[model samples]
Target: MEHLAYFDCPTGVAGDMCLGALVDAGLPVDVLHQQLSGLPSEVRFTLAVQPVQRQGQRATQVLVHPQGEQPHHRHWAEIRTWLAEAHLPPAVQNWSQGIFQRLAQTEGRVHGMPPEQVGFHEVGAVDAIVDIVGTCIGLHYFNITKIYCSPLPLGSGTVKTAHGIMAVPTPAVLQLCQQRQVPIYDNGIDRELVTPTGAAIVTTLAQGFGRPPALKLERVGWGAGGRELPLANILRLWLGSPPASALTEPVVLLETQVDDMSPQGLAYACERLREGGALDVWIQAITMKKGRQGVLLQVLCHPELVAPCEELLLQETTTLGVRRQWQERRLLPRRLVTVMTDWGEVAVKVAEYTGRRVNVQPEYEDCARIARTHGLPWKQVHQQVLHRFWQDMGQES
Candidate 1:
C-alpha cells in the first residue's frame, strides 16, 4: 500500500500548493480545520477550495484567508510553541518542526540577521500559519506514508515582496533549502518560483529526491498556486501504488573489451568504478586472432560518469578506447537489513514482502566465515540463518 506525491514544480511549489494537492488527494477540509482548532491560539482563519486551471487544465486551489480579525505577525518561538501543541501525528510533528526552521532561516537571511535571530514576518501571520499547519494536517488525512518531489522550479531574476524587492527564490528560500536537500532550481519563470513557507514544508516533508518513484498510482490531485499565469500555476499530485515492476531513471552504458590489462590492475580499476557508483562490472576470458588468451573487462555506469570513468581508464589501464551506448534496465525495489544468525551477525537481503520475507539471503562473506569455522556446508548454514530470522519475526509479532 503506497501513495505517490508528485511535485509539478516546473512553476515552483508553495505550502498552499501542497495543501491543495493533499486536499485534491482526498483529505477533507473540515478535518483540517478541526485539528487546527486544537491549537492554543485564538486566531481564526478559513480554508477555501477554489478551481484553478494549469496549462488549460483545471485544478483545485487551496486558499487560506483571515476570516474576521486583522492578522498579526508572531516570532518563530511563539509559532513553534503553538505548533508543538497542535494535534498531529508523529511524522507530521517532526515535519512541522523542519518547516518552521526552514522558514526562520530564510526570514533571517532576508532581513540580514543571523538565521537564529530571524523571526517570521508575513509567514507568521494567521493565513500563512493556516497554510503551513493545514498542510501537515492534510498530510495525515491522506494517510500518505511517504512524500517525494522533483527538482523545485525556482524562477530566475528578482521578486518584489512585502519587505521590498529580493531575488526570486529569495534569501529565505535558499536558507530553507539549505536546511534540507530538496532539489530546487531557478528555471526561468522569473518570478518567485518557490516561496519560503513552500520550500520549508516541501523540503522537510519529502523523503528523498529524484524523478517520482515507480508506484501504484491511485489518483491524480491538482493543487492551484492561486496566482494566475499566462501558463498554468497548478501543482500536480499523482497518487500511485507499488507496481509489479517499474522503469527507473535511465543510465547510459560505456563499455569496451580490454584484453591486455593485468588482472590485478583491472580489479583495481573496477573498484574505482564501484566507488563512484557504477551499476556493474565483470570480465570474460576471450581469445584474440593471434591465439593469445586474456580477460575482457567491461564496465557499466550512468551517463554522467562517462568523463570521469574515461579519465580513470586512461590513467589506470591500457584501454585505448571505450564505446558508449544508451541502454535500458529494470530493478526491483531494494533495501538492507542485518539479521541475527548462528555465525554471529549476518546481513540479509530479502525480497518479496509476504507479510514476512519469502526469501532471505545471508551475506556471503558471513556465510563463508561461518562455514570455514564450523566445517559446515556454506549453503546449509546460510539456509539456517534465514530460518532463524523468520522464527524471530514470528515470535516478536
Candidate 2:
C-alpha cells in the first residue's frame, strides 16, 4: 500500500502552514518537538499548534517561537553543516537539507551569487529552520511515500524580507518555480501568498503537480495562513493510500521527433531514458516536413520522472521541444521465482490475475547468462527453466 499526500494549495503554502497541515492530519506536535530537538542549533524554540479559523474555516496554525536571540543570517555552508551533524533520522535530515539547498540555489541565482556563497535572510531564521525540519519529520512520521501538489496560486503586490521589500512571488519563489517549470497563477490578492520557504519545500519534494492522483482518502487537514482573505487562507492536505484493487496507475508519455540525429545517438538516448527510470522507450520511423525521414521517440514513465525524461530527450536527441501527456496503464500482479536448472538457477516471472496464473516465462537475461556459461542454446535454457519452475510448483502443491 503506497501512502501519498496531496497539497491542495488553493490559496498558497508556507513552511508553517505545511507543518500545521501535517499536525492537523494527525501527526503529534510532540513528535516534531522530540525529533527536531536533535538538530545542533543554538537557537532554542518550541513548536505550538492551535486550532484556528481562516475566514470561517477551521484549520491548524503551527507557530515556532524562538526562546532566545537567533542568528540574523545563515549561510548555505552553515546550514548544511548543521543538518549533517544533526542526530535526526536520515530521511528527515536529507529532506530538510534538500529543501534548504533548493532555497539557497534559488536565492543564489536571484542575487547573482554562487550557491555556496549565498546567505539566507528570512529563510535562515530559527523559525524557518524549524518549520522546514518539522514538515519533513511530520511526513516521515506518517510514512508518506509520495507527494503531489496543485498549481500554486501566486499572490499579488509586494512583501518585506530581510533583503527589504520585494515583489510578491518574490525573486526566490519565482526562480524556484521556473527551475521546476512549476505551474502558477495570479490569485488577485494584494499580498504575498506563496512564501520562499513554502515554494522551496513543495518544489523540492513534490513529485508531480496539477490535480490529485487516485487515492482512497483517509484524512484531510487544513493549515491556515496568518492573514484572513476573502476565501479560506489555508493549505489543504489530503492523506490516503492508493486503492488496492485498482490495476491502472498514472503514467506520462513523452514524445519527440528528431531527423538530424544519428541512429546511434537515438539508440543511446533511449538507453539513457531507460536508465533514468523510463518504463518503456521506443522509436517509430516517420516522415516529417520537407520529406525528411525521422524517428518519433516516445518514452513512458511515471509522472515523477517526466522532468528527467524530457531533459534526457532534449539533451540526448536533436529535438527542440518534447510533448507530454498523462496516461493510465493497467498492470498485472507479478512476482519472481528462482528455478534450478541443470546448469544453474534461473529466474522466472509469474503474472497472476484473479488469483490464477495467467502468464509465466523465464527471465530472458538470466536464461541468456546461464546459456552462455553452459555453452547451450538460449532457447533450450529458457525451456528448461520454465519446465523446472512448473515441476517445482507441482511438487509444492
Off by over 4 Å in 1: 68-72, 106-116, 178-187, 246-348, 352-360, 365-397
Among these predicted structures, which one has the highest TM-score?
Answer: 2
Residue 283, candidate 2: Cα error in Å is 1.0
Over 147-188, each residue of candidate 1 has an lDDT whose tens digit, in order, gives 766777778688776677877768777766655545555555
Model 2: lDDT of residue 181? 64
Q: Where is model 2 more than 4 Å wrong at Cα?
A: 187-190, 246-250, 290-292, 302-308, 328-333, 352-359, 375-377, 394-397
Residue 127, model 1: Cα distance from true site in angstroms: 1.7
User: Could you tell me every candidate's TM-score relative to the true structure?
Assistant: 0.68, 0.88
lDDT of 2 at 179: 77
Q: Write the per-residue lDDT of candidate 2 for residues 339-363, one digit (tens) a residue.
A: 8888877788887776678789888
